[model samples]
Target: MDWEYFFELLLGGLTRGSIYALIALGYTMVYGIIELINFAHGEIYMIGAFTALIAANVLTMLGMNELAVLVLASVVAILYSAAYGFTVEKIAYKPLRQAPRLSPLISAIGMSIFLQNYVLLAQTSDFLPFPSLIPELEFMEPIAHIISSAEVIIILTTAVVMILLTLLIKYTRIGKAMRATAQDRSMAMLVGVNVNRVISTTFVIGSALAAVGGVLIASHIGMINFYIGFIAGIKAFTAAVLGGIGSIPGAVLGGMVLGWTESFATGYVSSDYEDVFAFALLVIILIFRPAGILGRSTTQKV
Candidate 1:
C-alpha cells in the first residue's frame, strides 16, 4: 500500500490540527472564563497575520535575516493582537457585562464586521503573499518531501506552547487566579481575585496564541487575505465545541480530531467534500456526546 502517502496525510493533518488547536484554545479559554464566544476572536487572528506580514516585509527590506524577521514579526503580531483583544473587551464587552448574553453576542458580531471592513479599507481586498520564516535544516532534507520544515516548526511550536500554557495554568499566580475566577467569579472577587484583570488577561493570552497560529499558518500557506480569519474562526469554534467549549485540553484534542478528519477526507475522498466531512463529524459528535469529547455535562437549577 501507499504508506508514504499515508504518512504525508498524517503530517498534513497534524499541522492543520496544530493551527486549529492554537485558535481553538482562545475560544475555549474565553468561554471558560466569561462564558462568551468572543466571536471577533478570528478577526484578531487575521489582524495578527497582517501585522506579521507588514513587519516581515519591512524587516526584510532592511536586509534582516529570516530568523530575526520571524522573531520580530511574531512578537509584533502577538503584541498587536493582544492590545486589540484588550481594547475589544473594554469597548465591546465590559460595559455590557451584566446585560443579556445575546447582547454581547450581537456586539461581538458587530465588532467582527467592523474589524473585517477596517482591514479591507486599510489594506487591500487582494491576497498578500507571506514569506516563509522557518529555516530549512540539513537533517530534514530526506523527509522534507513528506513534511516540510515549516510543518515541523508548526507542530513543534504547538507542542512547546501547549506545555508552557499547561504550566502557566497549573502553577503561575495569575494562572491560579484564572482558575479561581473561572470557578466562581463572585467568590473569586470576594477572595481578592481581580476578575476584570483575569478576564482581560484571558483575552490577551488567547489572542496571542491565535496570532502565533496566524503567522505560522500564513507562512505555511504562502498567502493570506482579510477574510481568512472568518473561516478559520468558525472551524476553530467548531473544534472548541467538539472538544467541549469550556475545556482547555478538549480544545487541543478536538482540533487534532477535526484536522485528521479533514485531511483523510481530502486525501481519500475529494477536496470539495473536506468541509462537508468536517462539519458532518461535528454533527455526529454533538448528537452522541453533547457535552463534547472532554466536556462535562452540568445542570443549573432555576
Candidate 2:
C-alpha cells in the first residue's frame, strides 16, 4: 500500500468535508430554528464569493497587502451576505410564517431561481478567476507533496468555526432563545422571546457562515461563477440531511463521512462515480437510521 498516497487522500477528504460542513452549518442551523430548508441559502453563498472577488479586485488596485485584502474582502462578503439573508427572510419567508409549510418552501425555491438568474445576467456566465487568499507558507514547502497550506487552513478554520458555533448555541442568550424557538415557537413567544428576532438572527448567522465558506472555497479553487452555489448547496444540503437535518453536530459528521466516502472512492476506484458512492452511503444510512447519526427522533404531539 502506498502510505503517502493514502494520507494525501485522507487530508483531501478532510478539506472537502470541512468546506461542506461550513455550508451545511447554515442549512442545519436555519432548519433547527425555523424548520425551513432555505433553498436560497446557496445563492447567499454565491453572492459572498462574488462580493469577495469584487472587493479583492478593488483592494488589489489600491495596493493592499495580501492579508489585508483577504481580511477586508471576506468582511465585505460576510456583511453583504448577512444583509441579503435578512432580506430573504423578510421578503420570502416572513410573510408566509403562518401559511402552510409548502408556501414558504415554494417561495424559497422561487427566490433561489430568481437570484441565480439575476446573477447570471449581471455577471458573465464564464468562470471568473478568484484571488488566492491562503498563500503557501515556506515552512510547508517540504510537505507540499502531501497537503497544501490552503487545505490545512480550511480544516482548521472549519474546526474552530464548529467549536465556536457549538459554544454560541449552548451558552449564549441568543443561543438559548434559538433553542427555545426551535423546541416550541408558540411557547417561546409566550415566554417573551422575540421569535421574529431569533428567526432573523438564525438566517443572519447561517448566511455569514455560508459566506465564509464561499470566500474560502473560491480562493481554494481559484475560479467561480453564478451557478456554483446550486451544486455546492445541494451537496451541503445532502450533508445536512445525512447528518440529521436539525442537528448541528450531525451536519459536520455527515459532511466528513460524505467527504471521506468520495475521496476513498476516487482514490481506490474512479472519480467518475465519486458522487454515486457518497449518495449511496447517505441512502444506506437513512434506510436504517432515519434520524441520522447524531439526530434524535422527535415525535410531535400534534
Candidate 3:
C-alpha cells in the first residue's frame, strides 16, 4: 500500500466532504426545525453557483482585482440565493403546513424540478466554466504538490462557517428561539416565539450556507451544469440521514465519512462504483443505526 497515495485520497475526500457538509447542513437544519425535508435545497446551491458565475463575469468586466471580484461575487450570490430560499418557503411550503405530510413532500419535489428547468431555460443547459478566483499561496509551496490552495480554502471555510453557526444557535436571541422551536413548536409559540418567523429564518440561513457551498464547489470543480444539484442533493441528503438527520454536528460528520468512503472506494476498487459505495454505506447505517451518529432517538405518544 502506498501511504502517500492514501494521504492524497484522504485530502481529496476532505475537500469534497467539506462541500457536502455545507449542503447537508441545510437539509438537517430545516428538518430539525420543521420536520420537513427541503428537497429543493440542492437547487438553491446550484442557483447560487450560477449567480456567482454571472457576478464574476460582471465584476471582471469592471476590471476589479481577482480577490475583490471573488468576494463581491460571493456576497451577491449568497444574497440572491437567500431571497430564493425565502420565496420558496412562502410559496410552496407555508400554505401546506397543515396538509398531509406527503403533500409537502411532493411539493418540495416539484419545486426542485421547477428550479432545475428554470435554470436550464434562463441559463444555457451547457456546463459553464467557473472562474478560478482563489490565488495560490506561496507559503504552502512546499506541500503544493500534495494539496492545492483550493482544498485549504474549502476546509478553512467549512470550519469557520460551522463555528459561526454554532455560536449563532447558542448565543443569539434568534438562536435561542430556533432551539426552542426545534424542541417544541407548540410550546415555543405559547412562550411567544413566532413560529412563522423562525421557520423563515431557518430557510434563509440554510439557503445562505448552501450558497457558500455552491460558490466554493464551483470554484473547485471549474464547471457546473443545471443537473449538478440533483446528484449533490441526494448525496448530501444521505449524509444528513447517515449522521442523524436532525443533528447539526452529525451532518458534518456524515459528510466527511461519506466523502472518505467515496475516495477510498474509487482508489482501491473502481471509480464507477464510487456512488454505489455511498448508498451501500447508507443502507448499512440505516439497518443498524437509524438515528445516526449524533442524532437522538425519540418516541412519540400514541
Candidate 4:
C-alpha cells in the first residue's frame, strides 16, 4: 500500500477524467436537447485533433512562438470542429428530424464511418505524432513529484470551461432558449424560441468543447489516429450513461468515476481490463439505476 503510488494513479485518473468529461458534455447536451445520440460527435473530436496537428505544423513552419502556436492552433481546431458540428446537423440531422428515431441513429453511425474513412484518405491510416505544444513547467518541484503541468492544465481548463458553460446556460439569452427547447420543443417554439437555432448552437458549443478536449489529450498522449475517436467516444458515451445521459453534472461525475475506476484497475488490477472496468460499471449502473447516478425517473403522460 504505497501512498505515493496511489496518489499518482489518482492524478492520472483525474487528467483522463477531464478529457472524458469534455467529450461527454457533447453527448449529454445533444441528448438533453433533442433526445438524439449524435454518434458522430466523437469523430468531431478526432478531427479537432488532426486539425490542431496540421495547424501546429503550419505555425511552426512560420516560426511562430511556441505559446502563440499552441493558442492559435487550438483556436483554429475549435473553429473547424464547430463548423463540422454545424454542418453535420444541418445536412444529416436536420433533414431527418421528422423521421423515425432509428433513422437518425443509423444516420449518425453512417456519418461516423464516413468521417473515419474521410480522414483515413485525406491524412494517413497510420497514427500521426501530435505536436507537443504544452510547455513544461518546472515551478512545482516542491509540492509533489507525480503532478505535472499537463495535468494541472487539464484540470484547470476543465473547471473553467464547465463554469463558463454553467453561467452561459443560467444567464445568457441563447442559453435560456436552449433550456426552453430542451424542456419542450413544441412549447419552446410556441413561445418564439428558435428550436433550430438552439439545437445548432448546442452542437457548436459541444463540438468546441470536444475540440479543446482533443487538443489537450493529443498533447498529453503524444500521438493520435483516425480510429482513436471510436474507443474514446464509446467510453465518453458510457460516462454519460453512467452519470445520467442528459444531465450535465452527471456527465462530469460519471467521467471522473470512470477515470478513477480505470486508473485503480490498471494500477492494482491489470491494464488489460481497463476498458472492461468501464463497461462493467455501466452494466452495473444500468441494472441498479438505469437512469444513471443523477438521472431521475420520468413518466410519460401518454
- By lDDT, who's the top model here? 2
lDDT of each: 0.93, 0.93, 0.93, 0.91
Q: Please report the TM-score between candidate 2 and the true structure.
A: 0.98
> Residue 282 in model 3: shift from native, Å?
1.0
Each prediction's TM-score versus the true structure: 0.97, 0.98, 0.98, 0.97
Quality of model 2 by C-alpha lDDT:
0.93
The all-Cα superposition gives candidate 1 an RMSD in Å to the true structure of 1.1
lDDT digits (tens) for residues 1-302 of candidate 3: 89999999999899888889989999999999889999999999999999999999999999999999889999999999999999999999999998999899999999999999999999889998998877788898899988889889988988888788889999999999999999988999999999999999999999999999999999988999999999999999999999999888889999999999999999999999999998899899888897987889998868
lDDT: worst 10-residue window of model 4 = 136-145
lDDT for 191 in candidate 2 is 98
* Model 1 spans > 4 angstroms off: none
Cα lDDT of candidate 4 equals 0.91
Ranking by TM-score: 2, 3, 1, 4
lDDT of 2 by residue, 1-302 (tens): 99988988999998899888999999999998888999999999999999999999999999999999999999999999999999999999999999999999999999999999999999878999998987888899999888888888888888888899999999999999999999999999999999999999999999999999999999999999999999999999999999999898888998898888999999999999999999999999999999888888999797
* Model 1 TM-score, 2 decimals: 0.97
Clashing pairs in 3: none
